[model samples]
Target: MASFVIEGGHRLQGEIHPQGAKNEALQILCAVLLTPEKVTISNIPNIIDVNKLIFILGELGVKVHKIDESTYTFQADDIDLDYLESEKFKKDGSSLRGSIMIVGPLLARFGRGYIPRPGGDKIGRRRLDTHFEGFISLGAKFRYNKEERFYGVEAEQLHGTDMLLDEASVTGTANIIMAAVLAKGTTRIYNAACEPYIQQLSKMINSMGGNISGVGSNLLIIEGVESLGGCEHRVLPDMIEIGSWIGMAAMTKSELTIKDVSWNDLGQIPRVFQKLGINLERKGDDIYIPSQEEYEVQNYIDGSILTVADAPWPGFTPDLLSIVLVIATQAKGSVLIHQKMFESRLFFVDKLIDMGAKVILCDPHRATIIGLNHQSNLKATTMVSPDIRAGISLLIAALSAEGTSTIHNIEQIDRGYQNIVERLQAVGAKIKRVD
Candidate 1:
């Protein structure tokens, strides 16, 4: 465990570059198992979760070559299926939620996929029903060991079939798509998750000779192929991290320019911040945010309080609602944050409240935040980060508070963010990590 000691009430100015998408990297790494040829991937984020998955791949006997700090080439020409049954795998695979993704590629190529129930943030109920159900729909036999909390799927021969997912789960959609890509027939997946990560996976698979259509849409059509070959792919910059940087700039009133943001891929994130009265200017794929003394949150056109909620793609991402809630605490007007996806994600608002932000926790799924208008600065406090998104939100709050703030359990932050202390220090933020 580690803590972040921050000296607040300081303005920072500089350029920041977001790391490659963590969610995308998970799927892309697993896709390598579908091919025996070399697959090169660039812009890979060096974070705990992604690194853990890469280690698991290496343990499974994939030949990993480091091209540079941010790029790697993987060759899955030989795999040790026995590793899936090893005690070491039970421990390693269960530690990262992203490890669940390897199941799809394994089930497609080796006829068996096994993983101890994976773990990650303690946000809420993250069910694997969508994944197992989709596998079952694709003619895979499902098995679970209740005592060990382990799950497995097997298929002698996969035959694709059309399926309507119960929910548009991103990982679930990705897993099914990977498994379906190698099946014997065409698989049409409706109500699929079309997040940028999923679209990127589909595109990468297409370049590797997988026939996939209806990209960037909720309905995906995949015609099974015999085998996949290798192709080079570059991951997009993490959108969630980009949103957090935008929120930090507003809260600290810093003139920050984020480089290579891939503006069109940001969907509703920029507009969501704009609705909160944060100004964002695009200069040749870079996002330039000028310092503002105070920004006002916008109410509805009908003269009501604005409510921000999360939905599937083309909608505001649920991962950023915590940052949005924290940003609203300093705005001129009030806003309601409805976290429809996860029930426990809003629990960190208590830490915000203790720091002098006026917030009303409306049950487990919603909260109401009244703007402080910067008339009074938040008093410094000590808190513990419960999850990755909330951890970053608290870090933003700490940066804008009156005095020094201490945040413990920063391993959650490290799970998603890459070199956060160094990156912030480069941007003139007085932050340090206490190991």
Candidate 2:
């Protein structure tokens, strides 16, 4: 296993760009299987999860061409559907949560999809009920093998139907939309996830000759097409990574520039950081954050403690809540970090507390942070990265702490962040990866 050795209290300054979104890449990559034509995708982040999916696609006999580190053209003209039932796929597919996405396109075009229970983060109970339920509504037969812990869905030909999602799961919506795009009849999906990632996938599907309407909204209507062709698409910059940089700049008191951020697409991200008194200005496509000695959290007009919670799309992303919690440890006022989505994500707060940050773990979903206000610097210590978001948040804490810090289980970080050590090093951060 590799770990990060950080010499703390190093002020970093330089321009940084957020890599292509990990969530978006997973959905878009899986969509290539919907058409036999060549689908070109650029700005694909070279991370562990995305790479794993691309490799799985190749193993399934999708013709893959690597244009550059960030671009790929995939032609699924010849697919080995039998690979889904092979032992090799069970082992490989079980390692990545994104592998579940392969099911939608496979079942749509080939009539059957099989996958082992997928794995990714241990955040909480990320159930697949929504995804399978959507498939079932679309006339697919579902089966589970208890001994093997495998899930399979099959249908001779899908006929679309109207359904309302129990939850606005982003991946669920993507999977359902992908499957619905090829169904025989019209599909009306109410209460769908309208995240930028979903909208991007919808746009790509439309560009490929599918008919989809009511994009960027909770209700989506898809008139199924017999087939889809290939098209070119580019992923948007990762907003969560950009938000993480904002917290990093504030915690380390560093002046930084984040280039090519899709400013308008960053709903509530900038405002949420601004609420922490972190001053950032949008200079064209770049965001400039100046060095600040102190920042105070904002309270409601009624003089109540500010509570930051996660919600569905058009709301603050749950992925950045961990970053918000860590940076709050140094703000002048107290704030409640409500992680409504995942139960165990707040478990990393114990590590932050060990680093000398004042935090109260209310429960699995809530924490109260009393900012140290720069009058006190966090004491550095060794910790372990629990998940992708928690790992980055801890890295920010380590960089702002007074002494050298060590973070174990850094592979969790690499699962989502693309060349994180290299990027941080370029921006003057004293970080290095070691075995």
Candidate 3:
């Protein structure tokens, strides 16, 4: 396994451009199976998760070619759906939570799909019931084998219907959209997930001749077509990465500028960071973060200690809650970090507490952080990453610490971040990837 050795207390001051959205790119890549023509995706992040999905696509007999460093051309004209049932395919496919996305497109285009249990952060119990429910509503029959932990779906005809998901799960909405894009009738999905990722998938489907409306909203209407032709689309900028950079710049008291951020796509993230006393100055497509000694953590609307929580789209992303929690430890005032999405995400507070930050873990989901206020410097130590976001948050914390820090389980970080150490090094961060 590889680890990151970060020499802390170095200010990072340079321009950084985030890669394409990892979350968005995963679903879009799977959607390529809906067409036989070449589906060209630009600005795609070259990350571990994306690469893993490409490997899975290749195993399924899809011809995937890299056009450039950040562009990919996928042609599934000769896709062999039988490979999806292979044990190696199931094993490799189960390594990512995004593998479930292939079910919809596979079932839509081939009338049957098989998937093993998908893997990701053990943050919380994310159920696939919503996704299966949507598939059943679209006329798919499902069978689950507990011994193998595999899910199978088959249907003669996937006719669209009016369906309402119990939870606006991101992958659930994506699965249904991919399935419905080639179904026979109109499908109305109310309470759908409208995250930028889902909207990007919808745009890609529309470009391929699927009729989709009400993108970026809770309600989605899809008019099924006989088939979809391949079209080219670019992945959107990673807002979460941009947000992570914002938190990193604030924590290290560095003057940094983030380039090419889609200003219009950032929903309430800037305001949420402002509540933590971090200010962002927008100059066209760039976001400027000036160096600051300290930021005051404000109270909530009720005048009590402020509690920042995560919700679905139109809300702060759950992925950034860990970053915010780490940043709050350096703020001037106290605040509550509410991680409603994941039960075990707050467990890392014990590591931060060992570094001398005053934190009270209320439970598995909440932590109260009392800032160090630039008066204290965290003593460097060795730690292990538990998940992708937690790993990056630990990296940011390590960079802001007083001495050198070693973070193990860097594979967790690489799963989502593309060439993270290389990118950070370019911006003056003294980090080395060691095995």
Pick the winner on lDDT between candidates 2 and 3: 2
Taking all chains together, each candidate's TM-score versus the true structure is 0.99, 0.99, 0.98
Q: Write the per-residue lDDT of candidate 3 for residues 43-120, one digit (tens) a residue.
A: 988889889899999989889898899988999999887788788977998998899999999889989988999999
The digit string of per-residue lDDT tens for model 2 on 1-435 reads 999999989889999999999999999999999999999999999999999999999999999999999999999999998899899999999999999999999989999888999999999999999999999999999999999999999999999999999999999999999999999999999999999999999999999999999999999999999999999999999999999999999999999999999998899999999999999999998999999999999999999999999999999999999999999999999999999999999999999999899999999999999999988899999999999999999999999999899999999999999889999999899999999
**Cα lDDT of all candidates, in order?**
0.96, 0.96, 0.91
Q: Which ten residues in a row have the lowest lDDT in candidate 3?
A: 348-357
Model 1 error, position 269 (Å): 0.2
* Candidate 2 Cα deviation (angstroms), residue 124: 0.7
Score residue 121 of candidate 3 by CA lDDT.
87
The TM-score measured for candidate 2 stands at 0.99
Q: Lowest lDDT 10-mer window, candidate 1?
A: 372-381
What are the runs in model 2 whose C-alpha is more than 4 Å off?
none
| Model 1 C-alpha lDDT per residue in residues 199-255, reported as the tens digit of each score | 999999999999999999999999999999999999999999999999999999999
